[model samples]
Target chain A: MTVNAIQTRRTDPYSPPAEHLELQGDEPVAFLDWRDGRKAWAITKHADVRTMLSDVRFSSDRSYPDHPAHGGYVPGAHKGAIIAIDPPEHSAIRSRVMNEFTVKKISLMRPRIEEIVAEALDAMLDGKSEAELVKELSLPVPAMAIAELLGVPYEDHEFFEHNTAIFADSSHTDPSQRVEAIGKLRDYISKLVDARMDARGNDILSRQLDAGLDAEEAVGLGFLLLIAGHETTANMISLSIMTLLDKPDLLQQLRDDPSLIPGAVEELLRYFTIAEVGGLRLATTDLEIGGKRIHAGDAVYGLTNTANRDPEVFPDPHTIDFKRGARNHMAFGFGPHQCLGQNLARLELVVVLEQVIQRVPTLRLLDPISAIAFKEWGPNYGISELRVAW
Target chain B: MSAHIVAKRETCIGAGQCVFADPDAFDQDDDGWVVVLQADPASPDAIARAKEAVNVCPSRSISVLTRPEPGAGTGEAG
Candidate 1:
């Protein structure tokens, strides 16, 4: 099909588009994105997405002026962030903060994570019958965990959280305002990084400082960990709860067998696959992926949401089957640029879900599913607010 | 059965699946690169876990070589 003939699939935050699901058997489709008006290739199949992500020839360096960005966001200008850079620079920067997310290290934080979850749940229970899960439990748990990790004072969470929400909300279209929000975050993190240099704490920022990263590098690392550390996990938590409430059978299964919580979490992650835009890369050399030849400097967007639901790899991909091995899903992404904090995200989800099912036995959505506000466009896909009550 | 584990550090991407799956056999260094703790594991559980680690490795940098049984002949070598 010609690029002009390919329709831009309308995406729902909760479900993969029917158009994308139907186009699974076809070659990777190309389209001019309505938002940016840039022509790019959309990788739909699971095998193709994985291959595109792993291939070194497809560069993640978006800092270059020619790199393709969605909706006029120039990633190349935002230097020092690990996601926007390719290796060996990416590997070097990633290694400095990698130890903080190891299973053993994150497992040590389980007690504190559980405490945060309990406090949030307690506030929700004590307040009102109709509680907003996003604000109550979903946002606070990860916010607090990441705050503690970055050694940022918990009292100032509101400032950082609000700023992060602005950039994360795809509907918030004021470019100038987004730039201002980023500026505020950078200044806030810069101060924190400076303070940690004088008085090093046990948090990730202090660790980065102790490891000999300059002030600027430390700020970039801290900025990435602070924004990414909480926002993605918080959204995943909110989305997971909504999915469980929608499917009472799945919720009941978790309630019946608490051991199924981890498996259920994996399945939920795969089914939702929140990073709707997938990983973005500009080809460093001419490459052929899925029978399509991409020339040098071409931009390729991996549609991970579509890939996760590709029937070739996942039999009956539309259905959420907890029994299936879904850990390999690209929800956390694949290849060298896979999520740095996946272990922490997984631990937080497992703890929060298990506690909610065990403690809040009667928890159910207070609002109709149709009324829920889902984010229409953004790097991440999740609900804006999820109202739940027991 | 005993198994030999080798971690190709050059190819390791620090996904840490090996350490997650079989901590006894594999551990990460300060930089988060894989560090093989036990090349020859004695326990059957560790051996099984090592196999899982090999399967889940994103970079395919891990390898497990199992030794033949005590009385088993090496027909191929002969």
Candidate 2:
């Protein structure tokens, strides 16, 4: 039995680490060895990955030692962090706030989201022909959106976005800096939750409070949203733009037909599958996956990045096709813990692409894709900086 | 025969793919459970969207069933 070491380095910018993709073909459910001496199962096939994720037998509870999903942070200890819990508890907390992100609710946010995108673009394109797209556009759009969603005051936006960028983009900062940012953001959210308790508002935090969530739970929920909402979306925003600018033909496809932008966004998500480790689980009971019998008490990883490229599910999986309508991809993940803000993310991407393509006729990448710094070590895969000019 | 959409709310994880697929046919209740707004799709576009909803639903909570149209299936039809 051969155990392949988890490969984090990507030989190609548009694909997962080569070893993982190789494993997807040679051994779809391969044994894995982690750098920290953790032995686990890595499932890379699309069907198997979905089965592993949707089954409650594969526990998501991260309280146990050697849970592979932690990535050095133990969010399982945090109250109301639904992503770290399972079953009734996870559903209980998720239900409390899920309504805030419903398709109807998020769709209602389109006008405001468009305004936010326009504002970010306005700032980025104002009095300038070139700017680093990450700092100028990608970072701020999602940051401001999350801030408004949480009712973070206009005055605190700078502090909130700054700390979140440092904390979320772990590849760019030292552990201590990331820790400091988390601490600062936690304290800010705690204080804000306290303020909300005294006087409520129409925001997610206040709504959670109204739904009988105590201060700790409210703070935990708010903090999670503040971090999760912006960082992943911000990364997606930049990566999608960078991919577009890198491939002029693809970019021209969207430019030629604005209607293609939405489909292109889904294809980009499938192509990138940013979350390197998709659904990490601990087997609660013996189960068979991909014709391999696994006993209880084993750690498992559903390597979704590679799963997205599984040739069986996606024909010519390596090729990027905008019309593929790859909605079934596990990019936002699957099952109970699937991304709650997926609708919002899609809306933001569509609006951003529409505005960027329509407004910035000369937008071009200032650096080659290979020259760009990819966040290889981080929990999410994305570009650290995208320099672009109009 | 017509295609009818049924969503099992208990099994839904509120992924919202149903609504994404066919907003006219599905929605999320206030607590974010799946709500079927239209049980029988009227248009080909709507039926196609209903099928897409079934395809993308992560929980397998949605099913599209085909049954005879109301009066046409009855022997006493006018």
Question: Per-residue alpha-carbon lDDT of model 1 for A96-188, expressed as tens digits?
Answer: 777777767888899998998998889889956778887788777877787778877878878866776665544544877877877887888
TM-score of each: 0.87, 0.93
CAPRI grade of model 1: acceptable
Segments of candidate 1 deviating more than 4 angstroms: A2-14, A28-38, A70-79, A161-181, B1-5, B22-24, B38-55, B63-78
Candidate 2 stretches greater than 4 Å from native:
A1-5, A35-37, A74-76, B1-3, B41-48, B66-78
- State the DockQ of every prediction: 0.40, 0.54
| Top TM-score hit | 2
Minimal lDDT window, size 10, model 1 chain A: A1-10
Clashing pairs in 2: none
lDDT of model 1 at residue A111? 94
lDDT at B5, model 1: 87
True contacts kept of each: 0.31, 0.58
Top DockQ hit: 2
